[model samples]
Target: MDTLFDLDEAPATDPFDPSVSRPYDLLRHDDGADYAATVTGGGSAVVCGDAERVLAAMPAGCVRAVVTSPPYWGHRDYADPAQIGHEETVFDYIERLADLFEGVRRVLADDGSLWLNIGDSYTSGGRRTRMADRNNAARTIDFRPDTPEGMKPKDLIGVPWMLAFALRERGWYLRTEVVWNKPNGQPESVRDRPTRSHEYLFLLTKSEKYFYDVDAITGPNGRRNRSIWDINTVPLAESHDAAFPPELVYTCLSHSSERGDLVLDPFLGSGTTAMVAGSMARRFFGIELNPEYVSIITRRLAGRAAA
Candidate 1:
């Protein structure tokens, strides 16, 4: 395997520095032309493009496990019109995600599984503008999606379950829903309801009997893993706003995949999935639309190689 760049030496550049142009140009992997497989310990590739477009070029049934957190509906805009999560209506957002996962199901191995992490959203209450929040400056938005039909203002949209059932309708087996409890979740300004502190992680499979190792993810009490995960949310000091905690990815990887398995993450924000996959000796590749975010992925993976 080719070293990403001599692991023995210090990394030539810092990934967090925006001025650095070439964090490392990660080659796009398609069919048998997978340069990511050449990394010394484990392979990783970052495809910089829209998720649907990039997934089209990959081989069928090639992925052993998928661990991803697609963009949440009506959340912080990634500044791309083509990006998901900002549909005119909530149902439209679900349709778009369901349609994209159809391609994901096609590329998944028959016995493979998908661990999806998604958060819910509230109705816009007819508000068209969103001011920047001091806690999360990226929450600023130029446009706000209208509340869905038959829903009142400030209603909990339940987007996670909506998308989960949508995928189940598309032939995915919805096996489980894991509550990801964020003990250090960002404070919400709403006083009417309890401060939201959790998101949903749904485990879906392509077939009835899939490749999940129950023994691998035994709870601390030496029993089966429970539905609620008490993992803290990790903050990234980078341009990408929503980088899910690596512990979440690590737990998903542990339960669903083995070493050398090909793991896929369609929404590779900040490359957390790829970094954790490589550390565990699993081959990984991901799709991201932002070019700047793609640089973050390569720089991160390169840092892992150097370590």
Candidate 2:
């Protein structure tokens, strides 16, 4: 079996380097050579390219579980056209995600599972509010996408369910939604409702029965099967904006996969999934479109190996 793990071929791009000229510039292989070599290297293989294209190279049924938080709908743009979630409308966004996951479903084992962590966005006057562009590394107004039905100003678009139902319609068995309650939620200025403190993590399986180890993630007392999860949101100094805690990944991997099982993260932001997968003795294949983030993943893996 061919693997894609060529760390030495990576360009070692620095995120903080202001002298770097141009966008999507990676210090690694630009002709997709390292990406082709990704399957060869053992441990975590991080590919910096379009997720849809990268996932196509993966062998079917090679992944045990697919876990990663994709880009939020119109929240922030990573300055990449190939990146999802920056669509012109909420409907378009969900459709694009569902289409991307078609490859994901194909690569997933028959007994595999997919855990998706998606965030919500509010509509201002039947449209998504503008936020940071991330190209200049500053907060600014972004392009406004078309509004979806039943959304008013200051109303949450329910992006999670939109995506969930969309995926379910595409032949994926819609499973339970795990509420990720943040203990230290950011303060909000809304006076009509309570502060937002949670996001949804959907657990979907391709088949009726999958490789779920119920006893793996048991608490001290016994098996805790509650749906509401109290996991904190993680902040990173690297290029990633929305990163979940490693404990969250640990819980998902513990319940869905075993040691040495292959895991796939289609939206590898800071490479947290690969990092935690390495610590837990699981193989990880990560896909990220941003080159800077690919560099961050490379730097992070090196640090972990040294320690």
Candidate 3:
């Protein structure tokens, strides 16, 4: 298995920063030479131009499961000229993401499942406000840290529903919308509505019959008593400007995949998915547009390997 970081030589410019020229040059490297070596060892990865192009490189029907959080439309500036989440229109964003998933479907096994974790977005007072912005605002306002925490920033806006609908239109069967409830969510004081506290984990299947080892990934509690599952929040060593919690990655991976299965993260920002996948003894294939984040994820994965 050839990891994306096993390049022959480092590029001249940083790949992730918006200020840098030829930001995608690193992904264009001919690292396929190391693919077999890496994959055979049970943990391999490749970084490509985009999810669409990356999916092309994968062998059809090779992947058993996909547990990823694609770029939330209009969320962050990935420094790439073609940002996946920062689209000009929501319709364009949905179409773009759906297209990527279509490619994902091609590479997935017949019984594979895609556990997609995504939040929502909203327009506030004629101005578009991201859920992240609202969280930041709550923090800036000095809201009581102990107040009831609501949904992840993405849910505050509504991207999950839009994505679910889009994926459904693309022939995916919506199996379940699992709620990832954060036990230690940030405090918020919203006077207009009830405090939000959970995000959606849409489990989609290619067919009614899919390969899911639910018993292997179930929580210590051992029962799906409710759609909500409690998880802890931990900070990253070096933030990638846009990233979700590793716990989120862990939960999705454990619940949707098994050991030695390949997990694909198209928006591999900061490599949280890769890092967690590596730690859990799973194969990971990631496609990150920004080289800076590629480096960050590589360094973090290397650290985990060392640890």
Candidate 4:
């Protein structure tokens, strides 16, 4: 094993400071290569680029697992036009995300699985508010379609299954829609409808029989775990917005991948996937469009290394 870092030293610089330029560049050397030079532990390359372009650079059939929760349709605009979730309509958002996964399919191993978590969007009344406990703006879906085109206001757009079906049509096998039940979900003010406490995590695979370890995620009854996963929604203590809990990320990676296997998280918000992958001794490659959050990932990883 490579001893690329020791746990006792102060990091080269602070990752949380917005002033850090390409935080990884702190490790850049006189030689042409950069901190991403070696591909393990803190040196893992988390390129800040469009997911499609980034995935193109990876070797074919190399990634063992593709786990990510793309920005929900009508969600926070990472201030980048290239970001996926800010599309005009639900179907358009679905198509755009599915197309990106099409690129991902090329990089995933034949026996690998793709786990996607997406939240539903409701037709808006024009007032934008923070997402349930995630401390990010819940963007209103931009286009107002006629009644024939989409459901009326206050109706939930089925974003998760729509993308899942689209991917299934694109030749990936749709495996499961695991419900992420947030037991401590933030309260909604809508009196007309019941409060939503869950999101969907769809598992897609390149082949019929992939590398899921049923025994790894089994429940106390000694059987395979059910579809519903009761995980609470919590922000990263590092103040990362729109970040899912590390427990959720750990469960997915634990069930689907093995130690030392390569995991890919293209969205890489707050670096939860990479953090979990590192703790479990798996290699991770991540891509993020937002430079600020990339800094968060750098700092989060440094904290782990310094521990």
Top TM-score model: 1
Instruction: Assess every candidate by TM-score.
Output: 0.86, 0.83, 0.74, 0.81
- Point out the worst 10-residue segment of candidate 1 by lDDT: 15-24
**6, model 3: CA deviation in Å?**
27
Ranked by lDDT, the better of candidates 3 and 4 is: 4
* Model 1 misplaced regions, further than 4 Å: 1-42
Model 4 Cα displacement at 274 (Å)? 0.1
**Candidate 3 whole-model C-alpha lDDT, 0 to 1:** 0.62
Judged by lDDT, which candidate is best? 1
Please identify which of the two predictions, 1 or 4, would achieve the higher TM-score against the true structure.
Answer: 1
Rank candidates, lDDT, best first: 1, 2, 4, 3
Give all candidates' CA lDDT scores: 0.78, 0.74, 0.62, 0.71
Off by over 4 Å in 3: 1-42, 128-157, 217-222
lDDT of 4 by residue, 18-47 (tens): 332222333223443322322324424577
Model 3 scores a TM of 0.74
Where does model 4 exceed 4 Å of error? 1-43, 125-148
Indicate the TM-score of model 2.
0.83
Candidate 2: stretches off by over 4 Å: 1-41, 126-141
